[model samples]
Target: MDELVRWLGVQLDADKARAAQWHDLECSIHEHQEGGLLKAVAALEVYGEVPGAVCDCGGPARVLREIDAGRQLLALHLPTPYQDEGDRWPGCTTCSWRDEMDDLQVRYPCKTVRLLALPYADRPGYREEWRP
Candidate 1:
């Protein structure tokens, strides 16, 4: 559990960093005087926003919010190093939706708590492999 939580935190940081880098690259390309101009404009385009998780709809899904599953909430409040890992269950709401008949469809994490919960290094970027 602890390992999973730590890995998740690392993943979150990596995701944010990747997003920032992408925005910076885009801004450099457009060379706008005002700040965040590219971000605002790119938000309207597909693949403009950095993907948090793989979505079924083929679009980037964000972490959105942490879903409390029992004791996980308490773990989230823990201090940096001692905090329990893999407490928050991640889900994708962006690509998930209900059908005309109201049948809801959603995507779950690709692996179980024990597997994905294991500690791992942050993935630098899509082009690069995972590193410590």
Candidate 2:
């Protein structure tokens, strides 16, 4: 459970860094062109906007929004320590979903967290068991 949490944190950090890089690239392009290309393209209204046009660039924004959503899900579904007799087990606070095998409440790093981590499956330390 601790490892999974760390892995998710690393993935989120990597995503944030990528989003920042994309945003910097967009800013550099806009600064270099001074919106001249965007203005001309908007005037034509044929392509509406270039694939990464500064006028309608949503690449970084979209990625950042997705990151925000992932963060929100992580915040909501947290690892809670529950004492069962003399032992402690990690459980999910917001995960009320039942497991198909036994119809019992899912454990920590539940399906929601697993789904959120799906995009980073290729990253190091991601286990196949984490799949939803």
Candidate 3:
């Protein structure tokens, strides 16, 4: 697999993990009666700087929604191998637009995927070149 494709997958996986963690926390808080300690933990601004901080103001439902959206977007922009002049290149499934001059398909990890990965840029394993 291409390095960029691998990197994008890692980023998306990281997002899912974070969302799962938040959902678990939310569930625990709701299920248990920890009193002030749980309230204080929930009130903390740990995720304040993170994009799409659904856990801050909403419950597990919101975090699940975000996770579903990410999954759908990733599904739409999957990396596919295509043949061009006897050589195979990675291309995007949903980005079928052709370049005017080259008439070639958009490369894998297309603009949509790049933008999807943008929110997790602060996380580890993010590359500067991956910015859209």
Candidate 4:
């Protein structure tokens, strides 16, 4: 298999595991409903700034951008497969704790460059709640 595909598979597995944890703790849902992993991965964003802090891989950290779109924009489009499974994916951004989000974003450029899970207060539910 290609490196990027392999990397994505690993990332997906980790994300799915995280979703299971969240479901057990918060949602009380058991099955791996579609988009569960995506929702969990999207919720891992850090909002504030940190001075003199480098990524786990020793690279400069990328700060969060002002996202005008909804928090669950990515979730709106579920079941979207890898753009080109045959093509090699991009390398990880070299962050700690298996944060290949940047790499995934780069690989799927058409999705959205700005990734931030801002609080959608006015709404009555979480992004995953409205999965269609």
Cα lDDT, all candidates: 0.35, 0.69, 0.64, 0.29
TM of each candidate vs. truth: 0.24, 0.66, 0.59, 0.20
Candidate 3: where are CA atoms >4 Å away? 23-56, 86-88, 99-102
Cα error of candidate 3 at position 30, Å: 17
lDDT for each residue of candidate 4 in 1-132, tens digit (9 for 90 to 100): 132223333444444455444321232222332555522212113212344332232111111111212223433423334443554543223211223553244232222311222233233323342221
Model 4 TM-score, 2 decimals: 0.20
Q: Which ranges in model 1 have alpha carbons more than 4 Å from their true place?
A: 24-132
lDDT of 2 by residue, 67-108 (tens): 899889899988765634543446688875446753436677
Q: What is the C-alpha RMSD of each candidate to the true structure, in Å?
A: 15.6, 7.8, 8.7, 19.7
Which one is best on TM-score? 2
Give the lDDT of residue 110 in candidate 2.
Answer: 86
lDDT of residue 62 for candidate 2: 76
Q: Can you give the lDDT of residue 105 in candidate 3?
A: 70
Provide the global lDDT of candidate 3 against the true structure. 0.64
